[model samples]
Target chain A: MKKKKKRLSLMRKRMFAGYLFILPWLVGFLVFYIRSIFQTVQFSFSEMSMDAINGGYTLTPIGWENFRYAFLEHGSFKQTLTSSVMNMLVDVPLITFFSLFMAMILNKKFPGRAIVRAIFFLPVILASGAVVDAIAMGEMMMQGGVSGQMQEMEASASSAIAFDIDYLISMFMNLGLPAKLLDYITSAVGRINDIISMSGVQIVLFIAALQSIPSSLYEVAKIEGATGYETFWKITFPMVMPHIITNVVYTIVDSFEQSEILKLADTTTFDMWNYGLGSVFSLVSTIVTCIILVVVVGFIQKRTFYYN
Target chain B: MSMKKGRIKKAFQDPYQRMLLGNDIKKFALTILQIAIIVGVCYVILSPVIGMVVNSISGDKDAYNPMVFIFPQYPTLERYKLVMLRMDYWPTITKNVLYVLTLTLIQVLVCSMVGYGFARFEFPFKKLLFGLVVVMIVIPTYTIKLPLYVTFRNFDPLSIITAIKGGPINLMGTPWPMYIMSLLGCGVRSGLYIYIFNQFFRGLPKEIEEAAFVDGAGMWYTYFNIMLKNASPAVITVTVFSLVWQFNDSFFSNLFLVSPDIVISKKISTLASVIANEDKILNVTLQELYLHAGIILVLLPIILIYLLLQRYFIEGVERSGIVG
Candidate 1:
């Protein structure tokens, strides 16, 4: 009877120990992350006071005007959003194809594959904060007439492309139905840069997944007199489908830099010092994020999750 | 059948049979195509970085030409030296970085250790606790920033041994805020490392622990002595990831530290802040030097760590299935 009582107490002690292990994260989430979201949502519907005179914390509650401004009034917000998304559309497919294509090439026996891999991987290093900025600075210097070689080329190139999106839009309008449709498609693509840049991480994930497929599967296919194309579609492609779905979801989660909605929220918080407004904007973005997860991930999971 | 025999004969009769086994002619063609395509890929993707590296080392960088060839006629390390000094060499650079990293390690350690306990042990709300861990990932940084700000602002909770650190310390400007945040296993991303730990720890073989149990070892003893040591690869992966990530984030660094002025304007001096404020970068011929210095300072740790633990750290992140 005493031994049985001791065992019961031991179980209780072990349970407490388990809680202690996870305590730091639990404290962190409660204090900061989870609470912040809740606070933002609470603050959203209220009108915020920004009176510099009184230095009061917040004021009366406001309504849906903030959302209205973000969605409708701000042309710059719209432009930045379109540009980001457009860049993503072109970027995601192009990056994925290139990285995978390059990985396949590197995986093969080659004299200079290592050198090539090193060169390709250099961008990841360079893209970090300071290096990228320096690089940008150098480009600015080059364009500002420091370079003897590039001076004429920069001039000629700028003249040729003239990169005016509005002008291109005008040209599309002239092209009639087909061009207009193309323009619509491209602009629609341009709204989500988050998807594009995040594709880099996904590309790496896919490459890893591709390499994991047993060469034995391909060997078997080849034994049956199968061609490389058939092996790719049947064996290599299907095996890596799970990875593709995971990477896509991962990309959406990362969202890298702040989105337009988040940016608007930042302006409210930091720029205007309207914590209430900022919080509301954030709540809305978080909701948007959940909706995105539901649409993209939910669908993908239903289709391909059986492989898991 | 005769048809199959005819097909085999036709296959044997083909003149271009060398293509199948990488015959020199076909291999040569493929190699050439691969090289060309690879070059294009390199050019499009790496131009900015390549351009920067080339331009920085170039003797004629005063011309600031982005299209210079790979080799500089007059190579310079002058920028390298200058950039290093400006980025705060000692405690601020190394100290802040190291402090945050140590915090991350402890955070991950506690998290995974706890995670291991929860995964393998039976406790109240075992399922409920695991559910919370999953929920932790989806929570955004913006949500907790204010409450965190308040928590860190609370002097008593954080300031028990104020004299211990020789200042009336609040958690805000120092590494404490970052430390406390990472302690919970949430870095820049949504609980990536902690999630990784849970995912990885759950996969560890249970037989080892069972043996420990038979030997009458406590769960803690089995975990630390047996399972923890056995889980070396994952531990390495999580450590390297948390180290690299916590080190890289400028956002929280920007958020946490208010300059002595303790205003938003002053706090805006984090590396990201400085980069964005272009007007502040003194545009003397010194800009090149400053630019070079900044890149070196930012990249040196990464490059140095990459070289020193090149085998372990890089492979760890890659194997952990995270981006390197």
Candidate 2:
């Protein structure tokens, strides 16, 4: 009885220490995150106006008017939301597949692999916030004068060397592929830049997953006379299944960050100064994202193989 | 020559040798195809950056000349000099770098602590708390931007400031909001950093902790002296990520209205307008050349850091156990 009591005290002590370790984050989470989320929810249901008297804004409780405005009255909210969701649906699978494929290739022994890997991760730096904005600004400015003509010439030259998408579409049409599948493929090709830029972190995650898969498994497969394709199917794919889910979630979140809806919300609040409507926009998107995330992650989690 | 030809014929005639030769040829072809694909993708990724570099160097004559496509007939450093001066590049970059580095350090420390707590502890509501971390990651910053901005703008915590100072403090246009957020482990992508550290810590054997306990080291001592040192992979991963994200971050900076002089990324956006107003060089195309130079200037420090840490960063990611 005494020994059990001592053990209980020890457990309690350890738990206390754990809480101590997490105290800073817990405080921040409660103070910053939870309060912000709560206020945002409250804002979505209220009208906010500048309080000239007290200097801070006042939130007057109004029912679902903001949400109604967002859903029914707002011109671009619905379109942006749907398009962003659709983009996510299209992007997630493509990014997952492309990153995994790249990761597999990158994991192999090759000369200048370090350089290639570094080059692949370049987007994580360059395609991020202000750099991309600045580059786009430059590109927009370049589109008016001599550079525009130069760009046209360069595009034609590249398309001549590269297989034209139009030619490929015609060839595939003659070969009688499904129109929907062809549309998907064409869209994927069109957004190839977006896909490559977004897949940097996903590729890193997949590479980590690939590297963590024990070489012993592959040796055993080889010993059993399995071919490369067989070995990949039997060992590699299932082993990396868990990371596919992580990458999918990551890609979805990333896409939403870059989505038009978030930008619309930003404009609504900061530019338009419609705080209630902006809150509604963000809240609806967040809830939709949560639903999609739960559904997709739940689906993937079912099939995810946990090796240990 | 006759003997060599006979040997080749003999090898070709053997079924095993023929199959081996065929497999080798297939492997070689696959390798060539893979290289082509990699090279193509790399070119696509790099082309825009190359374009920016080329444009930044192009002289006024080259900017207007239709013949200068990828390369400039006459390259000049004049645009860079003007941009550097107008953008206040040196002072702004130094301030931004300091801000980013400090934030990165705080994020690593606080996140690793929180992650270690989640990873090693058997506390009440542990699962629920960790779920909040996941929620933190999932919830877009836009969702909370308005409230967060208001909260910081007023800067009152539980009526403490309100009671003492008779009103709330406005933290907008200052670095305090970012510092406070980071110190409290709520900075940009802090959830992801915590998750990485948690995953890494959980992967470590429990034996280490037990041994430390047996050696009479307290939890804090063991954590600071032992576990953290052993978590270099997670540290490096978190450090690089935090640095890059914080450096490129416009969301939080914009939300808090952080001064353009403090966040150099914010300065890039206004560079063109600033140049136009200050220099009276109102030509959009000419102003664009300066903007490209400014972009290159912003990218230079980050690219340099990435190059220096690329090896360790890649290795860190591989071993950080972020896959789970």
Candidate 3:
């Protein structure tokens, strides 16, 4: 009885230490994240106006007007939101699978592996902020002037290649593959650049997952005389299941960050100076993303195999 | 020739030898396929970057020339010179680097502490707290951008500033908002960083901490001396990630209206128009060349850092305990 009491006291002490350690984050989360989120919801239900007489702005309660404006009245909000969500739905799985495939390849030993890995991760830097913006601007400028000629030149250059995508499609059709599957494949191929650029971090996560799998498991499969294909299904696939969830979550969040809806929100808030409507845009997107995230993560969590 | 053919036929008839040859062929074929896929994907990734590099170097004559596709006929450093001068490249980059580095450092420290706490101890509301962390990751920054802006603009947390200074103090234009957020473990992507560290710490064996406790090392001592040393892999991953993200971050910088000198990326969006107006470079295509040059300049420092750290970064991720 005395020993149990002593152990309980120790547990309490450890819990105290835990809270102490997390104190800063707790304060920051409540003060910044929660408060801001609350304010955003509040702003979505109110009208914000500048107080020229006073120093700051004021929010007058206006009910569902802002949300009604967004859903029913706004021209591009619904279209942009649906398109962005559709893009995420398509991009997330493609990125996850492609990253997993690339990770498996990169995990193997090869000459110039380090250099190839560096090149693959280049998008983590380049696709983020200023560089991508500048590149887009430059492309837009070029399109107006020189890109027409450049596209023609590219057409000729690509025509010199012996293998044609059209020929491949025809061959696949001759083989009687489903047209729906073929359409998906062709679209994925078209978005190959976006897939490659977005999958860098996911690839890293998967490589780490693959690395952490115990070699003993493979040895056990080898002793059982399993083939490479069997080993992958029985061992490698299950071992990396947990990371698939992580990568999916990451990919979804990343896709949302790059989505058109967020850009629309930015323009609405800062450029158009429509704070209430801007809050409505962002809040709706966040809620939708959160729902998708919860449903998907929960589904994956149910199936994820935690080896350790 | 007949004797050699008989010998070869006999060798092929051996099951072990046949299997070995088949395996070798399979391996070789797979290697060839892997190389093709990797090279093709790399080209898809690098083509635009390569285009930018070519455009940045091409002179006015090459810009207009239809035949100049991949290579420039009249390559020059003029665009780089002009962009560098106009962007005030050196001073701006210096300030941005310092700001990003400071934020990265604070994020690493604060996040690891929080992550360690979540990983190691049995605390009440741990589940709720961790759920909040996930919420942080899932919630769009745009959802909170305006309120966060207002919060910092007023700068009266708990009305302490009001009580002390008689009213609110504006932190909009200063670096304090970012500093405070980072210091308190709520900086850009801090939730993800904390999650990573938590995953890493959970993967570490409990015996290490037990041993430290047995030796009379307190929690903080054990954490600082033993666990943090063993967490080098996580540290390297976090450091590289934080550095890169913070360096490229425009969301917070723009929301706070941080001075252009302190956030060089903010300058990049307006660089073309600035050049068009100031240098009288009215031609859009030429302005684009200068913009590309400016982008390359911005990318050069981060690229150099990435190259320098690439070896360790890759190795660190391989060893990092973010398996989940």
* Predicted structure with the largest DockQ when compared to the true one: 3
- Candidate 2 CA-lDDT value: 0.83
Cα-based TM-score, every candidate: 0.69, 0.87, 0.88
What TM-score does chain A of each model score against the native chain A?
0.65, 0.89, 0.89
Q: Is candidate 1 or candidate 3 better by DockQ?
A: 3
**Regions more than 4 Å wrong, model 3:** A48-58, A65-83, A143-165, A213-226, A267-274, B1-11, B154-169, B203-217, B225-233, B273-280, B314-324
Chain B TM-score list for all models: 0.69, 0.86, 0.89
Error of 2 at A242 (Å): 3.8
Using DockQ, rank the candidates from best to worst: 3, 2, 1
Report the alpha-carbon TM-score of model 3 versus the true structure.
0.88
State what share of the real interface contacts each candidate retains. 0.30, 0.54, 0.55
Ranking by TM-score: 3, 2, 1
Q: What lDDT does each candidate get? A: 0.55, 0.83, 0.82
Compared with the true structure, what per-residue lDDT tens digits does model 1 show for residues A174-228?
7775875666554534422222233444444454455445455666898999877
lDDT of 2 by residue, B213-296 (tens): 999999999999888866765576577778888999988998899999989999899899998899898999888888888988
Chain A TM-score, prediction 1: 0.65
The lDDT-based order of candidates, best leading, equals 2, 3, 1
**Residue pairs with backbone overlap in model 3:** none
